[model samples]
Target: MTSQGLHLIRGVSHAVFRGQHDDRAEECSFRFWRCGKGFEISVDGRDVNHTEFHLLWHQLVDDNSLQNLSRFDKWFRLWSEWKTLRDVLHCPTYTLKLAKTGTDMRVAAHLVAGPVDKPAYDMLPVHVSDMDNFAKGLPVCGSESVRPGSWLGHSPGPVRGPDGRLYTLVLCEHRALDAQRGEADMPSWDRIRAYVHLAHSGVDTHCIPRLSSLVTDGGLVAGVLIDHIDSGSSVQGLVEAAVSAEQLLSLEHKLALWRDRITLTVTTLHEHGITLTTPEYGSTIHELNIEVNQHDQVCMLLSFGTVSIVVGQAELEHKTSDMDELRTVFDERLPELIVETRRRLAAA
Candidate 1:
């Protein structure tokens, strides 16, 4: 059927671009929706650079439609045969490329979750203050807490300012400049090194859906994207300052631990054909890069130290790399981190 089908994600808001699996990947369009936010995506259309949004769809798609094609009609019959032959199916995702303006265009159907699942997170007082400060500055970015807020995780009651404009900070993360969150036990070195850029509080980490795939234990794992040209996040600048701060040496123990995890990651990467070898870490800033060969294509990278996994890219990227080797690193080691962290807490 030439006509595309749509799937509705109740709380996360948006109709999935359930389209015909054919050569015209560009023809597949999507509608993104969420709390007071909405947009559409397609080739040469509006906002082509929303890479993460496309990722969210690929990682989280409602295939309930798979059961609805009951008609033995010719259209359904033809489509069924095509679906059965597809070795790898995609859910949905966006990839922003350089537009005519030299800026990346977000091209994807991405929407905010109406009854969004903004989970509670742990945070420090100092961090919360920064998030509040950022919210005040970026009047157009994300929704801020009504009164109280945090240094980690999403806030509540995102409202359109009386300015009568509708804008949302896609997704952001709030943690230390070099901090990362995942199943706590042993940090997956390669995964951690995948995305090294730190996020500010209140910045939607799911901004572009980069890290939504691999961590989908129950569909909560996703990474945020940042619109550098348009943002209200002090976290980016703050992360830079934190890294180069000589005082950061005071947190040496934490840094050393992070390095240990990172080192293990690099070694493992080498063992598999993936190369993360690059720039010396003389500076505190993390400019790490993860290069992997996917489907015979070399040097596909994401942010270093980013512990996210989406299905599409990985299918193409890791298809040639050592998947078992990589998965073993996280699968076996993550549990260890969880146990050790608990032990430390118990002793304390």
Candidate 2:
């Protein structure tokens, strides 16, 4: 989307503060813009010295102190602390309220002084399209129809799309892009597109999260929306619970079933010319999600993690290595977990 398109979706307002700091009169004004769940605040005084404010802001960000404080408290400290900005008036308190317009939400800032409550100030809503300038020029397949929605919770969680389906937005990691490489040549995009291909390759998608759409901003690929998997339903959680309960026989039987399903999933991916990249930790079993049917039988083995497309003959080694590592997990890790659980039980 262009800047003009962004302005169509934004709301703007201004506010001024006047007070005395250390027996000296002070005054400052600020411009606030609110757009698509983002807020931008800018100081608007012409002759005001903002050296102290900039230094204090950098200090808070460097030590990560601002992250520990609430959003309102962060703004409050930045605006009200005289040591941070002497030219700015110290406002004692403030109130924040949210107003909803259809599916979109807007925030209103109100300054409170003693017994008086000032009218809520409107802020310009900055366009969400400006968030990812680095990914500009990367081709996005069918991204024109994909509408990014507000994050459901913390990032990497499900985001409700315009289609009303829950999707996990996987942002392209910065490290995946090489400095000398063009954005279109990034391996991350290739991996993402490979997954999208696998989703529609007529294989059983029950064991994998299907790629719904690619998220883009300003014609650049920013991220992808994939089917959301509940982390609570992972096979690791089930195995740990079975070990704690000392259901050795049942645990072994369930693991056998899961192993077979995983084997089939790996085979399917290999056939599609995709390689399951072994994570840095080397355990793929933790990424397996399980869903049981009404008859209490394991129904699905949802694979959730990183994967890459097999390009060269040398990259084919990943296929065999992935299978071998999974086998080791089932053969060694499962028994070790059982032994540890029993030892702890006996000691207790």
Candidate 3:
């Protein structure tokens, strides 16, 4: 069951953003990883001639000094790697077109070599069992189980790196063992992996999870090491717990802060020609992926999976749709939460 495709890199990373705290001590850990040639990447794995994608994110957006030229220069370096890989392998230019589905998405990979356009790769559906196998086989992180980030399910492993930083490991949708016994309504890792890369390549480090590695089993993506947020839970979790009127009111400033953070984050993504879709629950809580700091400030926004890079008019129109959805999520949900909290308080 060796996959000759992309995979996620195992383990966690402790990323320190520059110029945060006065003593350069205002460090927050984020996740990032690179793709290497293997069926499964080890914790100490390194991709030859490959740069960490998340580092590129930090370099581009975290620093205020970088100009548009600098950003282009940064992307040029990354494009060089892809170009080299393509040239060395004599591989055709692959255009992976993904379309949405009811439960998962369909990936249509086409090879282009000067007017010779044809199908290239198989569109395999990644199952949760494959993710479980990926987690079970990876080297155990210090002081944690094989599936460490299992709290959120879908087989996210927890790892405590040598640097003592915690991280959550997820199965990359692009690569894994082809399950003989299929699971129903399985999520697509192909789209998920693309979203992870987009988050690393599109958004800033503060508003998104740091991707540590793109772990692969030679060709397919096997697993991914992402930042483990040890901060407070999602705003949905906070609202759900607010049973008193006073407690709900206390969330006013926090909600405002979160809304502002999300708005800015979404706006920044849009500025980069990317659009993020809103969650179904009007919240990232459906995935419990949003992280709030102890001070009730949003450290990271959610739904990296929903990010789409705009290209033409159709995609551009999506920006307006996405923005409106986000506005509704942020503006409308607070009042409902307040009302629910008051009802709970009165009932008690």
lDDT of each: 0.28, 0.43, 0.43
Residue-level lDDT of model 2, residues 1-348, one tens digit each, is 001111111222112211112212122222222321122222212222344443433332232231221222223322221221101111232322222223223222333223222111211111235534422343333333433332211224455555666666554432333344433233444455565566556577445566666665434454567766554444555555553455755766777876787777778777887765544323333424344433444433222344567667745777877777677767876677767766765676
- Total clashes, candidate 2? 8
lDDT of 1 by residue, 233-283 (tens): 222222223333343333234334433444454444433333432222111
Which one wins by TM-score: 1 or 3?
Answer: 3
Q: 1 or 2: which has the higher lDDT?
A: 2
Compare the candidates by TM-score and give the number of the best one: 2
lDDT of 2: 0.43
Candidate 3 TM-score, C-alpha based: 0.47
lDDT by residue (1-348, candidate 3, tens digit) is 011211122332211112121222122222111221111111111211123432442343343432332223222223222221112122232222112222332222232223222111222323344544444423323212222221211334454443446765554332333345353322335334434545545456456566654444324444455676667777777777886777788777677777777777767666766555523213332224556767665755333334455568855776777777666666676567667777878888
User: TM-scores across all candidates?
Assistant: 0.19, 0.51, 0.47
TM-score of 1: 0.19
146 Cα displacement, candidate 2 (Å): 7.2
Candidate 3 achieves a global lDDT of 0.43
